[model samples]
Target chain A: MTAAYYAAVDWGTTSFRLWIIAEDGTVLAERRSGEGMTTAAKTGFPAVLEAHLAAVAAPAHLPVIICGMAGAKQGWVEAGYLDTPAALSTIAAGAVAVPDVDRDIRILPGLAQRDLQHPDVMRGEETQLLGAAGNLGDGRHLVCMPGTHSKWVRLEGGKVTGFSTFMTGELFDVISKHSILSHSVADAQVFSGEHPAFLAAVAAACANPALATNLMFGVRAGQLLHGATATDAKATLSGTLIGLEIAGALAAAGAVDSVCLVASGSLGALYRAALASLDLSPRIVDADEAVRAGLSTAAQAIWPL
Target chain B: MTAAYYAAVDWGTTSFRLWIIAEDGTVLAERRSGEGMTTAAKTGFPAVLEAHLAAVAAPAHLPVIICGMAGAKQGWVEAGYLDTPAALSTIAAGAVAVPDVDRDIRILPGLAQRDLQHPDVMRGEETQLLGAAGNLGDGRHLVCMPGTHSKWVRLEGGKVTGFSTFMTGELFDVISKHSILSHSVADAQVFSGEHPAFLAAVAAACANPALATNLMFGVRAGQLLHGATATDAKATLSGTLIGLEIAGALAAAGAVDSVCLVASGSLGALYRAALASLDLSPRIVDADEAVRAGLSTAAQAIWPL
Candidate 1:
């Protein structure tokens, strides 16, 4: 049997996932928790990591590799950022080692596009991009990593030319819970990507990207005037924001040889359906596998097996 | 002293303003309070209005003419809506008198555009439109009533052809308080409409309204990369939303012979500057005077002196 190797971790703002991988790239153990950067910041990152490691019975000296907000300025250690027009391979090379540890530990730096007209930054998603890029062929590719902040990357050859971050997920969340539209979508049930209201809203928002707020208001107006259901209203809000993000993403990219969606679960399915409606078929990549692959890549480079 | 002929009230969602008018339409007394429809709904609209009426020494028999949320289904009484392209003059005639009240009291009906493509509803702004439209010379006029839900009415020959409601103000409020960007703008100070950040953001949003969420994210990126101030972040948020609104309003209205802005106070100044930056010098009409004029128009029609 292959010996247990390094531990790979994806530590987001509010989530933490760990995978103990064998030297042969097999997962020996896995753990997930709500103790992300925010929680770990107060509870202590070293203790949090030890507790999760102990649960999985991992080696005491097992090397660890982390990405995401763990490298944010306010997180464990500020790993900093790599300027745009950066190569994917350089991602692993930019890993910053955490000091005074029993075993080797490193956090990957994020990517930044400092253009005066269009500035943007991404921490964990860059690692996802690094792993997802290997799945894509050469030439120009539009890589979309959707989350609380959806990132649309302009990748050419093997380099990240630039990227844009759309607050689609966050906007949907705030609007659904805090805005006047909250009343309209409060009792919303689970709605699929194929829901008519969702499809229609996606199309309407893309049709007139400028009328986003107007279309959002239509969610409430539709309920009032046409008796649209709470589920439908929720779907509409989600669809409208997603559509606007797609419209802007596509518009900014101009033309791409292929579009790659690096997302997992429900969001992935939703984006696939939305992309299909817009006459584009994206090459789908699982976010979980991609992040793990990314961590493995950095692990291999740091501690050549 | 001129005797009070009728009391005109503009009861909004979160505010209430009243004026005692004489037989010759002279202002006999005025009252303002936070007792809007939301507060009055729970505390009793009649009691709220009676207290204000008594404070102004209003005569026992003085009829009240109200226009706003007081007429909503959830307010004092349901005044319903006048379907479009309804004449502005019909708004006064559509007033629903309060049943069982000793004195004659009526609430004006709101305007509703029932078009399947652009369904919209406006409660109090119809009265403002009725007042502001009179300021226009004729042909075609685009009336902008900025508020929580800014309404842009298309008026042609004194008729409200159609309108669109943008959730601009409310979006600003929710996003400022509920999103990740909230941290970036939490310590923001008062920024004038003339702030460079405001102008730059307005230009950028108008240039690519499709990229609104992206541009909004730029506020944080700008701060991270360029050390932008909290005031600039706040201004950017305001300008971006306003710019997107103006872009959509213009696109929806098409070509109009004249543009009129019916707003008061600081919001009015902000919109004016935003419009001016876009090379639009809209004819200004005070919102306070407009609502009073609208109530008086309905009052004169209901209670002829």
Candidate 2:
């Protein structure tokens, strides 16, 4: 398959990314923009696509694959998700093609939990799973994807068996900025995850797991009573929230011998550190790389010429 | 003591209040400005006093008493609190008199918990406690002050037995605006605490008071599974958090035979309502009225001409 150009789009709530790649998956050009699903209501889907395309010197007929919250209800088009125990073939078949795109475009359907009493959905992480499958050679592995809406997925032989979502990042931001914890957290200490107090906090949350509420109060009480620094309290709040998420996710996913972490950004590293504390040192992989490999897989499945 | 003039000031962190009162504590003339402790850096103590005094029609030697966050560290001057089990005398002794004013000005000292291993401080609420004491009579009662920082104070015979602060409102705002709960909450359904869903949520939180983190996940899960409305979920999250706080506060304050709740806003009323489900029927009193009555008590204490 000697493809002249390949394009992969990682579009989510906050941002959009377009990668112009060769057949070998080496990037030829890349474009990033502020036009994501969150801003898509104002920017419109066609405009978002056009803006990214305009930034890169790519052919009009380049085969394109997209992932992430771009397939959410508020995204460009609602490209639905495959239920748990999903097959790669079924996922590929479920891809919702954009009606009027110039090139061969396949939007990767996300993974969802439909077998349960109530259905939970995802949109873009399936691409990441495919990317992990391509790299890890298809086996039962615990995949941890950490973000604002962190996903813990179980992948077996290139198919997603089950997954759980943690509101870790969102909780961290809220507790630190809006709760009693905020009293001890200044905005300047937003990235203070490495502080010793932070690790102590993480350990505390992971210890009781049920004391998440008390843990938050402890931040304020620690400062008021124990003279814990505002910075330390802030870090503790962050660590506790993340630690709780880790415990919750692990419980939901059941125990696994090995953990394969699909992580991105500094926050993901924080999660990796948290998982490590819980005796689960994950095989870390960058989300960007995974999504790129995922696009490659999806591209191969569609235009295998 | 035939008083020609009277003055009452409700000074807080972010704002200052001055009221030219009658002998009966009727606010004949009142003025409020943004000269709170937050903006006090730009405007000094002298400036704050001058700005509000300038609103008066005449300069008389009227006795004035103030309360609230103005006694905080960054206020005009730190009006330190009286240690409990203390009474009006304790607070009066600590009152800091402001000089160079044409009138007798006394800043009321707030309440501080020095008995506990970890001290808890509260400004302005002491005056409210005085008012509540007057209204409820000298007996054991619980007061729930709801705001960004909600305080549940235990009082017995005009003395504050103990208190605990919960960041319920702030947490609600943060989770509803920043967390996954944000998705399940609409901007419109924030304050309708009487919603059936809100009561159900209160019950759910009360059921496992310790499982707040897991219970929060239930908001998103409930929405996904049961077609729960965003407003309902939002209210549920709010109820759950508040309910947890109630349970925690009740435990911390020790068991009570009866509860007479002194609450101010609709939010406070909602908290009272939530507590009611636990068979704790609280006799709700308006917080603002409590403050007014409390201010009158303070004025009487300072003047006593």
Candidate 3:
């Protein structure tokens, strides 16, 4: 087995992932847990990182590189942010090292767009962008990273010109769990991309983006008047939000030659299907792999083996 | 004091209001409580109504006229709905009488737009619309009644052409209390129409309705980077939702010569200010008086002395 050289960690708000990589860029071991910044802040970031490193059997003196909310003001260390128009490569230089620790540990800084009208920030997704950028030999590209706070970035020749954060995922969670739509979707069965209601809603919202909140209310109205199923209600809600996000992202970004979607699992599938409905096929990149690749790029830049 | 001619009530989802009307259309006595449909459904709607009637010193034999959620399927009696394009004057003919009751108590039916794409229903707002219509006269008019679920109606002559319900107020409540924006607006101070943030947000959302959700996230980003006050965050959230509603309402209406705003108190002021910012000078009508006039109109139609 190749000896592990350095560890790469993505510590998010509510999740933690660590990978022990060999000097030649082969992944030797990996660990994932709920010990993200939120949990780590309470349990001790050092202890959380130590346990994950131990689980992966990482060498005690091995250098470690981290990205995400762990570098936030409320995270493990304040790594700060790189303001736009920011060069993706300069992210490695902004890494804030953890002092007084036995091992060499560094956390990558996030990216911030200070535009007065569209001020936005991304912690971990910037790393994902850095990694995804390498795959697209770019003139201009639109990158979408879908999650709790979905980030839509505009990349011009390897630099982040600007980006917008749509509160799509979080709004879905809150509206589904806390709003009046909760009752409409309580007994919802799991649905997918091909659901008629989902496709219809995507079309409706995309066509009339101004009627978003009205369309959301239609979920309840549909249930009341047309006896719409819980699955239908849920799908409509999901599709409406996703459609609105896509519309907004496209509106913010003018004509672009290529679009890249950096997402993983079910969400990635959902976005791909949503984009297809709009007649655009995005070049897909696994979010997990992109973040790892980003961390790897930062790792190699900071420490040459 | 003139003997009570009839009792008028506006029973909503979370609030209840009762007024004893004299033969000359004067409000002889009034009573208000929190015994709305939700509470009255569990506590007994008849008993709750009796308590309020007693408080207002309403005569036991006096007939009653009611509107709002009290006519909903879950309320005291299912008053059903009058489908659009409906004549506002015909509302009184659709009143459903309370069975096995000593007095002649009739609950006015709501309005339903059964459009396959935009199914919508309004329980109480129809009454407000009926009363406001008298003031609007003959013409193509767009009516905006802002609340938890704001109703935007298109009135051609005296007929209800179509309407849309924007979940603006409810979305604001849920997002402020449940979403991440909650933190940014936690310490918000009370703001008015003149707030710069509020006006700016209104303009931004009106200009780019597709970017509604994106603008929402800016509240948080503004707080983090620009040191935005909690009031600014709250105002921006409020403005974004309202602006989205106005934009959607107008987009759905197509063309209108005049706009009528039927609302009362602070919410009314806010909507007026928001509409004014969009260069729309809506003809204002007191929602409280409008509902009362509607009930009076229905009462005279049902039991003319």
lDDT, candidate 2, residue B190?
Answer: 54
- Best candidate according to DockQ: 3
Model 2 per-residue lDDT tens digits across residues A213-283: 65576666566545777777677777877777676666666656568888777777677777776677788
Worst 10 residues of 2 chain B by lDDT: B112-121
lDDT for model 2: 0.71
Tens-digit lDDT string for candidate 2 (B149-254):
6677888776777766666777777777777677678654555657887787778656655345656766786676567777777777888787777766776677
lDDT of 1 by residue, A144-216 (tens): 9998999999999889998999999999999999998999999999888899889888898888888999999
Give me the runs in candidate 3 sitting further than 4 Å from their true place.
none
lDDT of 1: 0.91
Ranking of all candidate structures by their lDDT, best first? 3, 1, 2
Best by lDDT: 3
Write candidate 1's Cα lDDT for B113-216 as tens digits. 77777789999999988877777867888989998999998999999999999999999999899998899899999888799899888888888888999999
lDDT for each residue of candidate 3 in B43-118, tens digit (9 for 90 to 100): 9988998888887667789998999999998899999999999999999999999999888899999999898899
lDDT of 2 at B149: 64
